[model samples]
Target chain A: MTSGTTISGRPGISAEEFGYLAGGPGRAAEVAVVRLLEGGLLRISREGVVSAVASGAAGAGTPLEAYALGAARTGRMLGDLVKSTATSEAASALRQHLVDRGLVVSDARRKTWSTVRVLCFVAFFAAIALTIVFRVHFGVAIGVAVVALLLRWFAGRMRRPVRRAGRREVGRVKVAAGDRVGMVAQMGLLGRVGQFPRMYYVWEMLGIVPSAGATLRRRKPVRNSGDTGTMYGSSCNSCSSCSSGCGADNSGCGSGSSCGSSGDSGSSCSSGSSCGSSCGGGGGD
Target chain B: MGVLDKLGVGIGWRPEIDLTVERLPGVDFVEVVAENLHVEHLPESILLLRERGVPVLPHAVSLSLGSADPVEPDRVEHLGAVAEALGAPLVSDHVCFVRAGGLDSGHLMPVPRTRDALDVLVANVKTAQANLPVPLALENIAALLEWPDGELTEGQFLAELVERTDCHLLIDVANLHANALNLGTDPNRFLDEIPLERLAYVHVAGGVEHNGVYHDTHAHAVRPEVLELLGELRSRVDPPGVLLERDDNYPSDTELAGELAAIRGVLARHA
Candidate 1:
């Protein structure tokens, strides 16, 4: 649920600003903001900050729903100081999770266009496959492959050419394709950085016991209740190091997680561990 | 010789403890988490297992065979690659789903012990078997929750699965103990329900006490209750080997050696 705010000319608004926008603080505004944020019905940004690229409930049925869910989880983590991943890192984690799940999130306004692009990609692949099945002549097979690759390239290019529309859904906030793609890409990268955090979740899910390194020792219990009251607490405060050591924004406690730091910062994979490597960088394992 | 042929014990593979496993004398065979597989970067210990003639069988988590959705062919294909690499005698997965169409419960969820699930599981097992290099075995996981529409008892569910798929069993005695303690089901009756002849091995692990309920934590050495059940199974099933699973507070080789002494004492006295 999201809080609602009525802008003189806008449609969807964030819960954070809904209380201020509706001229008074109330439950409806808080709800409107949360629902809008959860459903990604808003696009947020400041004068110099990158736009808050959330969309409205209109994109619920599209692939962007995955992105929205990630955003919501990130937002909740943001609200809860759930150690590891800065708000931005969390946003990226949410984005990459959606991508790994095969959901390609884009601006809601460009939904129909992406749908067409996917269809063109499919049609191109189908042609190539069919040519192989039909035992097309060598010359013809090469032609089909070329045509299919070209069509795929064309579809990818079209993914970038969406006209910039100034229509603001979340109060005067206008969203665009570039912002959308950039957000999706940023999330993808962040998702990789979120590996340790997610690895935590996966082991928890599989009932696999975790590796308790010297770092995890002496963890104080921070329940979901620890949303505020302290700008920082626990391991982060005791050591001013970001708890995440991955990424953290200045606004949150320092647990080492900065939205911008990367886990693959200096480490490089060995040649055998490459894409064709056994760890299944290609998932063959 | 294989782990079964040697100390006749089943050991958990901790990539970190590979060298210790080789240098130490008592470990039988290691039940490698298919995740144990860093195919390209085989832990120096796995190579040692090979050098020392230790068998390392794989236990997988993501078969997702019992899902309502169609099984992904690539999953089995990848599993086959692991199976092919290890040449494990039996590849096992939890009796649960990893994902559904639009959701992931993120736990080893239990399936209803119904005819429908039986058919689904068998089909999934057959599919995995067709692609895998060895026979596929199914393990009985410690289920914390039950299906509202379950059609069979946990033992009956397992017996039928073994019958249908011809899959061997890696019955976790600790799991059965937890099931008994958690569900308040009698362990003797549960034991009588399944055919013990299909059991190739057994798993014993430690559990935690939460709200007066026992949960499989695998943190400590095998608890006393599970050891008791293992004693019972030793009398009845005469399973091949007993594996010790300690995932959390992995003691040093010396610490584990002490635990192994306790296990070998039981296995030997019974023999």
Candidate 2:
């Protein structure tokens, strides 16, 4: 679902390009990893370890994919995989390409903008000091301070790595990405860790916390026997109590017996009960 | 058996795999958990499926149809509203109680197979059916333990319920597999005794064996035995629809497709 041109007739951005524009090299690397995982070229374990099952496959078309495949050959943890891939020569080249297309600010330009903003802050304080010491008109000093503050704000905006065009391009990419792989790429470009419900485990494996105050709420992972966390207002201790074999001794009730209890007490078990698995012994609706 | 329109093959739709469900090839229908959706604001993914003419069935979990208490009107209302919103042909819930004595169990507890328990369940089902806009189908759940003083088997209990309430049945073979392994319930006997003509659909899911017990986890891959059970059911009747459910620990799309393919393969072989 890649598009070559935006609606405005400008060159559109690829998912990786959008990732770089939105969050930089690391984000682009994450998109590549997701692509490989979706393509079945790589495998991620429940523990978040990534291994390349077919590293020599012809699907490693992009440079980042090639780098990610190489990194996963030895079964690397997801966090380390992203880091190693992000710092690789391929990532550096991707950053350079985005800069060349004017979608992102150059490193030198961003550094200069940051320095100018600091100088503006210094000028603001200096003007206020001079006004108080030399008994100059308060209006003149206030004007100087206001101008310095405005300049500092402008410099801060200039220092942002992603330019206006780049943001627009990323937005376009998001609209065009309608399928599963594209949606995963959109999550990467938007810095939405754990936003993609199916891929949250991947982010958790990457050891990246969902960004603070993310718009989309982070959903609790699905409860399984493997997850001992609390769910549905109940805490599970172990898989033993939740198993179907918990009450094997009490299978049948006599016809005239008083065992016709309205509620099945064995259905839901507490943390202390022998059937303490809060997930209900793995039998879910 | 021809009462239900042919739904072919489908999968359970979850918020986690919205896009995957939307793009999965040959998806004839999808079942959404009724308790998880809001009628006023359905998910875009669901709306898209509806626009594409996919049958979106609402499967409720908290209905507590087998509870000793009367069926809750609010829960029934919500299920009805979801069905109406999705234009669903029918809706389904479990023949088990999730809450009783004002305490929520959070799991589908099997109803005791006693005449007294059956009387209460019949009354609740009729109440739910009267309030529901569309037809309601009840599914059999896998139980870790059965209540004592049982006067009937699982099949006889369901057959009487259908006779009393005229509700449909959603047979889950995986749950049958779990029961066959854990509680020694005879799947063949259940199939033989139940009224197959009243079956609206079939449910197939995956599970794992742990400590000599087969757990109906729905997180793992579908075992060979569960598929064999599906084959057995297919041998008895051509089910209107067979849906594959994967609730947690979702596999890759390729793996999920393969599972669906395996289910279709079993049906095809039996056919």
Candidate 3:
């Protein structure tokens, strides 16, 4: 998912250098380049400007070549201009390949880790309870609590970085071409601001996407999805915004509907409703 | 009256409407999803509420106290940790089972009203209470369907459970309305049957009617009938506080304020 030149099989200038011609990493721009390379449909000049090969597979005047040539001329990286944007597909493909070759661990390991973590917690608490029952002394209780807390804290610290590393395996490059160019250009103008753009993905994961007020507004579509009547999508999204409302990233969605169904409080106790411990913030009605 | 008596109108501190909630002109306290909050990294909004001295109740949804299986000690420990971290005086969860036989229903499924279910719920509640750092109040859930083997009325079941466990009640008037509307039961009769003194706080929420069945979805606006039910409950027993719960389709700040105002108005008239 890096915006760099890691298209392992491709020859000639790396994707980053080709991106330099269009200004930066993008979906449509990457698709055009890959198509050109695959079908030998375009000739990339020594100067990095891309031009249609007269006997190209897509021919000179075709929409694909025209778009590629246009991107080359204007230094624009088209991302998501057409339905065939390959960024997501490429990321998934690469991820699967890595998993297949054992370069990356399979998702089943993550599940095992999670289950083990929960069991660790259960064992830790059970020990604490046993200590309290057996010792029945204030000093013993304090010592046990302090030691347990420290152990839990250390365990959490150790797990977080590794979990984050595992997560990066699936983190796709979602940056658009224009934004990428703007990011590069603005890096100098905004000293530490350069680090800020890279943090966008992380911040978005945290649901605190800075300057995404409009993006939040566009999320109205979520409210209208099939789960709208049940308030599943919006509630879960809101719950996730509540600092990882449920346990896993998407677990909130499943429990969001569950929280609202006849079983829990149906809607009230689900992520946002104030029904129970997982009540998103709203009282369970 | 308990410490909750001094507290007044408040709303659930939903992250989606955190800004709207934070800006409320007057609020006694706010409740947060216990599972959503991490003890070490609490939401900034929740921290601000604590800084402002607004009580934050950690409401849990997955405890599944009535499940046949023993409650997870880890889950109870997590709840205890959250309560301690937030300095909450009390915490709350539902009286229904969320998972059974190792399969999570993903919803609060109803426990049978039989004596066997009652014994299981009482034992689970006692275990949860022992693990919790503060008092645990359990709320009754709104069920779309009832178990066939029910041997007691909902009120009688709650009354007996509370009597046995010495637990408090987080009564949801909206749930009462839903049950009354869908189950053909009298909400007033329900109010009369429950122990009024056990009321910790009252919960009011909104739901929709679909195909003649009232669904307590908490996604829609709080219907007037729910407010009326709250009024009726207040008349019978002035609960320590009333919290307005709005889960989704969150309206503008003005509308939320209006809902809070309406709740306050109801409390005022009853008072």
Candidate 4:
């Protein structure tokens, strides 16, 4: 709870805590599901329907995991599973604990701060309007507005749930997690899908198609904070258009080494070429 | 000592099954497609493998050494950067062309097996080798058609290329099987001619036959004939490394592990 408090003496932070610190309740739920899947307690079909493979909460390592496993019994979709789990009693309890530790802002406190901040803005604007209508001395209006502005700033600061200590904890956990799948799980769909593209079934089940163009445009070189090496740049301008031509610059030809061709060994055999037979029609060796 | 270091059985490191690759036991090394990766922003799984002291080889698909055009400098630089980043002992690409005359074929296309093509390939290989921080290993590809007027056999061409460039070889037995089935290129002839001492590793993958054409679809299970061919190669030389390539339609981790085990089995029996 405190800045100096240690979650454990172990190297990496727990996936649940890391998820909550990094992304909140929904992410924590997702991490739990990932854990269940990794532990072989749950199964997700290619269509994205998640089902509990194990009966009861026998193999679950945490309360959240047990809750997730129980919720998955009826075979909910991935999105639904995360949504329901986030609102579950277990997730609520976890959130309350974090709030008590001052790592997160309670919903009630956040709402109160938001209302006060809005009132401050309204009061400040009203004071200026009154001054303009009465043609009174502007100094009084300016002073009133300044006080309102100060109050608004304080409320805004209070509205943010994650405290400084929480941020520090998140960073520590991330560094310790390193390149492990635990880190990937903490990142939710983006990290899981990006690192494991073969899991496209997750997207298919979610009833959403990821835009290739958007994905390519948003892609930036991932650099660790400690890394000081130069990051290489990609010339792929458009994901859709570049498939056939982007990397095909004079720098090198973009051949499909996996595309079923004998060209890699200095032999002539192209499934895409005009010749369809075993030996291309041209000349004999 | 072997021509290359002892690299136990391995599998292709793909984005889809990254975690599976990490958990799968007995994986001595993993090969990554160079073009699919950005040297600056590598996937964490690859970095993890490197951190674990696992050999990560960058296999490029776009070097197009067999093309009539000059080797791409940017591509070579990228491959070199990847090798340096992973601290790999060597890297690999195919012996085919992907583009010609400013047009991209998008698939690996065979090069003419004449002296002229070999000269061009050798020059490109040397250029790539000079730029790369590690030794260059070239893999033979699976093809459906053979170009006319070829002057050399596949093994002779690869042997001459290695002799001239002092490069290494990544012989793909699955490709040899595909060629044998479709193009009538003898796998034994290929194994007999190439300098096995220069072999850095071997690639094994599964494929299917449709209408009598054996497609080197890395998606399928490794065919028995391919494993037999691997055994035949094992009979000739002790390859330092052997990797299973599964690019698409990935099976369960159990199936992949079984394939790797099958590869190990062949190596053990032949040994």
Which portions of model 2 show Cα errors greater than 4 Å? A1-285, B1-3
- Score candidate 3 by lDDT: 0.57
Off by over 4 Å in 4: A1-285, B1-3
Query: TM-scores for chain B, in order?
Result: 0.92, 0.99, 0.98, 0.98
RMSD of 1: 22.6
Give candidate 2's whole-model lDDT. Answer: 0.69
lDDT of 1 by residue, A1-285 (tens): 222232222354332222111111111122222333333343221111111222232443222233333443323321121122122332333323422333222334224444655576676667677777986676776676677666644543333211112111212443233332211111111112236455322112222123211111111221221121111111122112222211111112223232111111211111100100000000000
Question: RMSD per prediction, one decimal?
Answer: 22.6, 20.8, 26.3, 20.8
Question: Residue A7 in candidate 1 has what lDDT?
Answer: 28
In order of TM-score, best first, we have: 2, 4, 3, 1
For model 3, what share of native contacts is present?
0.00
Best by lDDT: 2
DockQ values, each candidate = 0.01, 0.02, 0.01, 0.02
Please give the C-alpha DockQ score of model 4: 0.02
For candidate 2, lDDT tens digit of each residue in B112-136?
Answer: 9999999999999999999998999
**Could you give candidate 4's per-residue lDDT for residues B98-208 as a string of tens digits?**
999999999999989999999999989988888988889998999888999999999999999989999999999999999999999989989889999899999999999
| Candidate 2 chain A worst ten-residue window by lDDT | A248-257
**Model 1: lDDT of residue A230:** 14
10 residues in a row with least lDDT, candidate 3 chain A: A213-222
